[model samples]
Target: MTETSTEGTGTIEALSLVPKAEARQSMKDFKSDQEVRWCPGCGDYAVLAAVQGFMPELGLAKENIVFVSGIGCSSRFPYYMNTYGMHSIHGRAPAIATGLASSRRDLSVWVVTGDGDALSIGGNHLIHALRRNVNLKILLFNNRIYGLTKGQYSPPRRSARSPSRRRWARWTRPSTRCRSPSARRRRSWRGRWTPTASI
Candidate 1:
């Protein structure tokens, strides 16, 4: 793979993936030197392990994979990866990943964001990126509570005692527009992968 740059845009030119005989990479190759620093027993640890394990399957060079994240506990992901990445502003990971993916089709771009970051502030960017099919693997860690904010209730938190609990309950009720099965089908048909699962 090769990359070029355009003046002032800071965007990488299209990469030409001329696969040559190269040695396979191990999981250690993707592991960074940074100390794994998160609260003990946090779910992020498992998520991190899962991602690191899967990276080798892609068979891409470490330099060609990028992890972009937004502000939150999950945003710390880029720091632990031994690949090129960006720890960007709150709710902007999708937008940044879109630009990078669109500009460098040869690179595998992934976004790591949490419920508050992706569903609350970055919701628009996330939906648009999916609609445009900008070649990205987005992982939304919906732990419900804001881990970085010390257990504060986030957008996905569902508890009677949660902050603004009633407001959230009201919002969860599907309106007429959101209840249409055809609309959901149309949206899903446009994307390559859009799966939701509890971790």
Candidate 2:
């Protein structure tokens, strides 16, 4: 479904980009035996459901997909999926995923990171991964607040009260906007809304 031009050669080779699955997949197929442990009514449940429901349409083999996540409450994502995955270090999922994608050309690499994990300490790592143009599906869940630490605000969270501050606190970084004109030009990016009770 794609083409790659050989260096120093004028001919372009067509590549069947995504590997066709040997069998049709189902939501149950992707559901791991591990218990679902996120906070009740957390938006992650919806994200998990949507992903599981849609995986079948991709016609991909479960074993061929991998999910990598960093340290955070959301980083526990790998545990809920049946496919192979890694629960990696803090703010290092993208860096790790890039290497995985590079070495395993036949596997589909996905990164699941939260606002703080991807935009704060992992900012540089995330930026470079995007620059590399590697085949990685980055899923950034911007819940607006730091859910795992439970004491501070995340990068995308606007100025607001925080647990650590106990009063109105300004954001450490400028509020993140969806308008990434530069990033949008090079790749596909989309957003969705998920209602949550609390973090």
Stretches off by above 4 angstroms in model 2 are 1-15, 161-168, 175-182, 195-199
Off by over 4 Å in 1: 1-21, 161-199
TM-score of each candidate?
Answer: 0.74, 0.82
The numbered model that scores best in TM-score is: 2
Tens digits of per-residue lDDT for model 2, 54-76: 87877777888899999888888
Candidate 1 local lDDT, 1-199, one digit each (tens): 1132213122222323412216787778778999998888777888888788878766777888899999988899999999899999999999999898877776778899988888777777877665554556677777766677665556655554645555535445222221245434323222222223343
Error of 2 at 97 (Å): 0.5
lDDT of each: 0.69, 0.74
RMSD of each: 7.7, 5.5
